[model samples]
Target chain A: LAKTTQPISMDSYEGQEVNITCSHNNIATNDYITWYQQFPSQGPRFIIQGYKTKVTNEVASLFIPADRKSSTLSLPRVSLSDTAVYYCLVPNAGGTSYGKLTFGQGTILTVHP
Target chain B: EPEVTQTPSHQVTQMGQEVILRCVPISNHLYFYWYRQILGQKVEFLVSFYNNEISEKSEIFDDQFSVERPDGSNFTLKIRSTKLEDSAMYFCASSERSGLAGYNEQFFGPGTRLTVL
Candidate 1:
């Protein structure tokens, strides 16, 4: 699995846009970038996923550049409730590996008022 | 949205005793997994189950630990003899699988916090 490095923490004010970037310098072709958001006392939830370029969902957007070395997760109009730990994951390559995630020390996002 | 559910949201056990953590994954998902996070540490993978057998496991899942899908509806992890270090939050996850792609979005359950004394 490609190792991932992300900021330890970030801060944002309400109604501001927040962008968190994760670098996976050793990423392989078969690796896909997926993000998960985890709130206190709750399980991590899927936010968005992308192989390349840009993919957006109702909750967030993921942008992957051509080099595939790093990806950014963009959250629009953040609110205090958006404060949580965000994780970036790249699965190990195999035929039968169905989402066996190796989690890193996720980036903690604190949304301020 | 369909979600994974786990039993006994918190379990407190004595060291050297046995304990079991149970989970019911999303109804239609085929793959099951176990992960744990020590206090203030990153979540770590334990094991993955598919076709009623373990497909992969990490070094942390030593001989003292075992996983079983005893029946259709439940998956359980049993620790033969718990140690103090075994205390952590255990999370169960499941995902649907198909084709040659080795990945799927896994849905996690609210973890069971195991406290060993």
Candidate 2:
């Protein structure tokens, strides 16, 4: 499994856009970047995933450069309800390592009024 | 959309006692996983089950830990002997496919808070 590093915390205001970047310099060929959002006292929820370039969803957007060394999760017009810890994971696609996700400290986003 | 569900939202047990955590994955999902999060720590993967067998597990999933489907709709994780270190939030997740098979999205349940005395 490739290790990912992201900001420990971030502060954003309501109605503003927030972007959290994760760096995985040793990403494998079959590795895919997956982002999960975890609110206090709840389970982590899937936000967005991407292999390269850009992928957008109803909740957020994931951007991965061609190098695949890093990726960014962008949340638009954030709200206080969006405050949570975001985890960026890179799991191998095949073999035993498959389906085993190693989570990092995660970026805790704090939305304020 | 159907989501994963867990039972006994909270559990308190004594050290050396046994405990079973239950989960009901999404009806159509094929892959099931168990993860634990210690207070103020990152989520750690324990095991993943597919097709009635374990596909993979982490070092954290030692002999003390076991997973069973038991029936058609329920997946369970059992700890033979609980310890203080076992206190944490256990999360159950399910994916439509294995990571090798496709872009897998593992949906997670609210989690079971296990406290070992």
Candidate 3:
């Protein structure tokens, strides 16, 4: 499995946008970039995933550059309820990879009301 | 909007006691897995089960830890002898079948919090 690195913490104000980036220089050629948002005391929830370029969803957007070495998770108009730990996984959403989710120390997003 | 469900949301067991954590995966899913998260720590995979057998397991899953799909609807994790260090929130997840016969995008349940005292 490919390893991922991301910021440990990020601060954002309500109504502001927040972006967390992750680096996986050794990403496999078939690897996809996936992001999960986990609330305190709950399971990690699926956010968005992408192989390259950009992918958007109702909750967040994933921006992957041409290199595929890194990806960004963008949350728009953040709210205090959005405060949670976000994890960026290397190409690991529903494939032959199975559930080998080696979670990194996720980025804790603190939103000030 | 189907979801996986677990029984006994909270279990309090004494050290060296036997405990079983139960989970029911999504009906159509073909894969089952167990994961645990100690307090204030990241979730760790315990084991993955497919084709009525274990496909992979972590170091944490020792001989004391065993899993069984006793029936079509129930998947269980049994810890032969509980320890204080085993106190954690255990989660059950299931996923559809992937092309290579591996699990697909896994959906998790609320989790069963086991407190080993």
Candidate 4:
């Protein structure tokens, strides 16, 4: 499994864009970067995922560099309800250890009015 | 949207007693998983089940913990003897498939908060 590092916390204002970066220096070639969002007392929700380059969805966008060592989750025009803890995971999606998600101390994004 | 659902949103149990956490995953999902999060801590994987058997488990899932898909729709996690450390929010997740190249997005339930006293 690859280890990931992210900012402990981030502050954003309503209608502003927020970007959370994750560092996975040891990520494998086949590893795909997946992001999840969790509000207080709720389960984590899938946000976006990408292997390389940029992948955009209605909720968020993921940008992966050529090296695949790091990825960024960009949330556009954030709102107060968008405040949550965001996790960047590299799941063991294949082989004997398939579909086990290893979550880290994710970045807590606090949206201010 | 078809989402995973868990029963007994909150459970309070005494130490040395048995407790069962139940979940009903999305009807079409094939892979099931259990994870827990201690207050102010990161989420930790406990176990994963597929094909009526366990596919993988973490060290946190000890002998006291067991998983069963006793019926077509229900998946349960049983703790024979609960301890104080067992207190946490247990989450159930499921996915339609596995593998990096395929659709492996795991959808999680709201979670069951278990408190041991």
Instruction: Compare the candidates by DockQ and give the number of the best one.
Output: 2
DockQ (Cα-based) for each candidate: 0.58, 0.68, 0.41, 0.67
**With candidate 4 superimposed using the best TM-score fit, by how many Å does residue B113's alpha carbon deviate from the native?**
0.5
lDDT of 4 by residue, B1-111 (tens): 899999899999999999999999999989999999998899999999999999889999999999999999999999999999999999999999865462447899999
Give me the runs in candidate 1 sitting further than 4 Å from their true place: B98-102
* Model 2 lDDT, full chain set: 0.92
Docking band of candidate 2: medium
Worst 10 residues of 4 chain B by lDDT: B97-106
Model 2: per-residue Cα lDDT at residue A82: 99
Clashing pairs in 2: none
The TM-scores of chain A alone, one per candidate, are 0.96, 0.97, 0.92, 0.97
Q: Candidate 3 falls in which docking quality class?
A: acceptable
Most accurate candidate by TM-score: 4
Model 3: DockQ vs. true structure: 0.41
Candidate 3 residues A1-113, lDDT tens each? 77899999999999999999999998877776778778877777768767889989899998999998899999999999999999887744445455566677799999998
DockQ, structure candidate 1: 0.58
Model 4: lDDT equals: 0.92
| Candidate lDDT values, in order | 0.90, 0.92, 0.85, 0.92
Scanning candidate 4 chain A in windows of ten residues, the lowest lDDT window is A90-99
lDDT (10s digit) by residue, model 1, range B6-55: 98899999999999999999889898999998888888999999899998
* Candidate 2 local Cα displacement, residue A63, angstroms: 1.4
Model 3 chain B weakest 10-residue run by lDDT: B97-106
lDDT score at residue B52, model 3, on the 0-100 scale: 94
Q: What's the ranking of the predictions by TM-score, best on top?
A: 4, 2, 1, 3
